[model samples]
Target: TYITFPIYSGITFNNISSYVGIQAGIAASGKRDNTITTSINGIASSENQLGNLSILLPDFGIRAGLILKLSNKLNLHAKYYQGLINIFDKETSLSDFTWRTQQFTVGIRFSIRNTNDCGTCPAWRT
Candidate 1:
């Protein structure tokens, strides 16, 4: 994932400062073990037992990202998260399915401060 932050306060654009960040997400597929027929006394038997398998594991163990400031009052940022999920039960006869995806985004910053506060002071101040 990627992100940026923009600060916009008092109509002024400040120099870029730590305003860029990056992130990465990864995932992997699950494996299953199958067993073949067994050999008996120099003779191969047709009967065989299917091997077992462990639960599908996810890869969201580490989620890394960054943040950046575009201006004094504005900020831009982004991040990404991911993990594997199995959608099948062991008892089910079907193969296990894994799904993955996680992410978010943010950009632009605004200030609610009164504009007059920074501009020329009140006029006609005797």
Candidate 2:
């Protein structure tokens, strides 16, 4: 999932103060008993458990937060993401589970167009 706050300025994208947005991501892993976990005679019973021999799982997550525009076509953004990832197979369900992983990120967006305000345009018009 994703969200954003649009901050528009009267100056046709001149300068912007701030904004807020959100995005979503997905990831996965595996759940199984440790091969090191041994049974009597030092035998690895987990291997016999056959905990989901193979796993293919998917999970959902959310993102939130704000950003700032330094100049037209150029801006910085910040956001926080929390996701619930579950790794389970047909026969594997580890009692240990995770709620979420917290994170913070910074990003920028810019344009390749040359700025006329920099006085780089043809001088003949003046």
Among these predicted structures, which one has the highest lDDT? 2
The C-alpha stretches of model 1 lying farther than 4 A from their native spots are 1-61, 84-93, 104-106, 109-126
TM-score, per-candidate, Cα-based: 0.31, 0.41
lDDT for 27 in candidate 1 is 26
lDDT of 2 by residue, 1-126 (tens): 223232332222345333333434434333355454557887655543433223324434455555566665676777665554542333454435444445688889785544435465565346
C-alpha-based local distance difference test score of model 2: 0.48
Q: For model 1, state the Cα shift of residue 76 in Å.
A: 0.8
Cα lDDT for residue 103, candidate 1? 49
Model 1, range 12-119, lDDT digits (tens) per residue? 234433322232322243455565776789898664455434433323322433445554455565544443344234555565454444545555655554433555
* Error in Å for residue 117 of model 1: 13
State the C-alpha lDDT per candidate: 0.42, 0.48
Which candidate number would show the highest TM-score if scored against the true structure?
2
